[model samples]
Target: MYHYDEYDRALVFERVAQFRDQVQRFTAGELSEEEFLPLRLQNGLYLQKHAYMLRVAIPYGTLGARQMRTLASIARDYDRGYGHFTTRQNIQFNWVELAQVPDILQRLAEVDMHAIQTSGNCVRNITTEAFAGVAADEIIDPRPLAEILRQWSTINPEFLFLPRKFKIAICSARQDRAAIMMHDIGLYLYRDGRQQMRLRVMVGGGLGRTPILGLQIREGLPWEHLLSYVEAILRVYNRHGRRDNKYKARIKILVKALGIEAFAREVEQEWQHIKDGPAQLTEAEFQRVAEGFAPPRYAAQPDGDLDYGTHLAMDRSFARWVSRNVQPHKVAGYASVVLSTKPGPAAPPGDLTAEQMDNVADWSEHFGFGEIRIAHEQNLILPDVRKADLYPLWRLACEQGLGTANIGLLTDIIACPGGDFCALANAKSIPIAQAIQSRFDDLDYLHDLGELSLNISGCINACGHHHIGNIGILGVDKNGSEWYQVTLGGAQGKASALGKVIGPSFSAAEIPRVIEQIVATYCAYRELDEPFVDTVARVGLEPFKERVYARQPEVSTCAM
Candidate 1:
């Protein structure tokens, strides 16, 4: 994890004080609701359906024990007892009081965290894979470059307010766990033939009303020009991205209007002015950032644990969990464990209580380094847990309701807090997600079904990233009622693709059965060991669509 220096500390504290005064002014009627809107948004405060929601940035989804504890404290002291981890690798504290926001910001700042750039139409949090450094297939650790981008973008006067919110994600692993192609700017760090770091830059990729996979604009870009290159891209977008309509303001729209070739040319032309400027990274600066994320000390141990295998064979439940939740780590004796936040029907997806947060912090320290990672899938990750200690950690995690063992299964859903909390939501997403979870609660069935991603979004803002789910469900407004529109064949990773809509929207009551039918269709068409996305691609969406709308009259598709 990157520790905040004096400058970072000063900037955060100063912003806190400034927001404190702004909140005071708003409360005292010195600022109207309209006047306070942008100011509050800039500080990551949103006036939701019932109360204010504060989104705190967990930069690159990395958290130290102290930072996690501080977040738990904030959740305990101020808002409701729990917070929701978002797809952007940030956490949202819903039900926060307007007046207490300053205090919450203060508490966050104390732990070297802040809500800065978590919201507002500016460059948001720079996210990366949860297993960035520890992933077995990684060419190089991306956290150093992520940290550099973070420092460069944070409060940069040139990009404070873009045409719309800008999101950038970096992935260095062979598997694109960070969903890089679904972001405004996606950077893939890799080593060239000479073993020097380089970037493959993807632009115009985002999920919203208009979901588009990013196009690779520049390949094999030297890592030294990352900041300058990013500046060039942003500068082009800032100059040409639409401001007349919010829906058309994103860089994706600009990229769509102008083809990738023209867009790349414009960026290259712009890059000529700034490519070799001070923003060009130097060896010392790179090393300075890289030092913050050096690998943790590890004890020498055998590659595989006999005891771990014994425990797996002994307990079927434990075996199931280990299969789904455990991931390969770069280290010989270490493994990354994803603690599922989506335990069952009762809990909303990606939600954790304050106590759960504290327990995870304790577990992170007890099991490995005092470090925690928030996966883009809305799960907690202990990146360096010893294989020998897996059973004990699993037991502790089970006790806390964080051991759901549904990592890539249907039950491990990605859903936004829809009409329940968010004012922008058209339909209630949580209940729908719960319905799906309840319908598919059997772990064996889910595991047998295999490696399926089900995502739901309340609206087309795509907070839940429904566009990329193997089975994507988007809530739509039909007349005055809420309905769901399903999309299939979407996937994330090296072969990322946006899902295609199956057919008409269905009522909320019909969603689970629809999902069940979709699953059944996949099972029927799939070959041995075929993943859901692969099956969808092979057979196309026609079979699923035919079955889904077989009994019901097709309702007209509407805006999600």
Candidate 2:
């Protein structure tokens, strides 16, 4: 985990003081709603359905135990005793008071955390794979580069106000766990034939009113030119991206208008101006940031734990949990564990109580080093758990309700806090997610369904990343009521693809049955051990659509 330098501390404290004044002015009526809107957004405060919401950034989804404890304290003292982890690997406190936001910001700053650039038309949190440093298939750790980007982009005057929010992700592993193809600018970091680091850049991917997978614009870029090349891309987007309509403002829209060749040409033209400028990353700077992510000390042990094998052989439940929750680590005698937030209908996806946060913080230090990670799937990661301690850790995790053995299963649904808290939501997302989870609570059945992804969004903003789920459910607004539109064949990773809508939206009550039918259709058509997404691709959506709409009356499709 990266510790804040003196400059970092100063900057955060200064921003907190500045925002404190802004909050006071707004409360005093010195600033109008329009006037305070941008200021508040810059500070990561939003006026949602019930109250102010504060989104705190967890850079590249890494957290120290102390920082996690601070977050737990904030949840306990300031707002409700919980916070919601988002698809972007950030956390949200839904019931914050506007007047006390300064206090919360101060507390966050104390832990070297802040809400800066978490929202607004600036570069949002830079993200990579949660298992970046330790993944078995990792080519190189991308965090050092991700951290460099974070330092450069935070409050960068040139990009403070773009046409729309920008997102960047880097993936260094063989498997694309970071969902890079779904980002505004996605980079694949790898070594070339000469064993030199290089980056392959993709541009124009986003999911909102329009969902488009990014197109590869540039490849074989030297690693040193990361900042310069990224700057060139942003300069092109900043200058020509649409300003008239927010709907058409994303870089994806601009890239669509201009073909990939034209877009690449524009970026190249811009790059020629500053390709060798000071923004180009140097070897020293890279090392300075990377030092923060050096590998933690580990005890010497054999490749596999004897006790771990015994537990797996002795306890069926432990075996099941290990199969779903445990992931391979590059280091011998170690593994990464995902603590599932989507346990069941009892909890909303990505949400954790303050107590839960504290327990995880303690477990991180006790089980591994004092570090934690947040996954894009909205789960917590114990990145360095020893295989020998797996049984006891599993017991503790199960007691804390974080040990649901459903990593890629049907019930581990990702959903946004829809009408329950967000003013932007068209319908309630939590209930629908709960409904689906309740219907599919059978673990044996879920595991048999095999590696399915179900994501739900309150609206088309795609906060839940519905566009990339194997079975995507999107809430839609009818004349007055809420309905859900379903899409199939969507997936993320190396072979990412956007889902296609099945047909007209269904009422909230009919969603569980609709999902059940979809699963039935998948089971009937699937070959031996074929994943749901693959099956959908092989047979197409027609079979599932025919079964889903057969008994129900035809209704007009809702305008997205």
Model 2, which residues run further than 4 Å from truth?
Answer: 552-560
lDDT of 1 by residue, 1-560 (tens): 78999999999999999999998898899999999999999899998999989999999999999999998888889978889999989999998998889989998999999999888989999999999999999889999999999999999999998999999999998888999999899999999999989899999999989999999999999999999999999999999999999999999999999999999999999999999999999999999988899888999878678889899999999999999999998989889999999988879999999999999999999999999999989999999999999999999999999998899989999999999999999899999999999988888777777789999999989999999999899998999899999999899998999999988899999998898888878777788888888888889888888877788633321111
Q: Rate the local accuracy (lDDT) of all candidates.
A: 0.92, 0.93
lDDT of 2 by residue, 242-310 (tens): 999999999999999999999999999999999999988889988989999999998887867788899
lDDT of 1 at 338: 96
Q: What is the TM-score of each candidate against the true structure?
A: 0.97, 0.98
Model 1 segments more than 4 A misplaced: 552-560
Residue 386 in candidate 1, Cα distance off native in Å: 0.5
For model 1, the run of ten residues with the poorest summed lDDT = 551-560
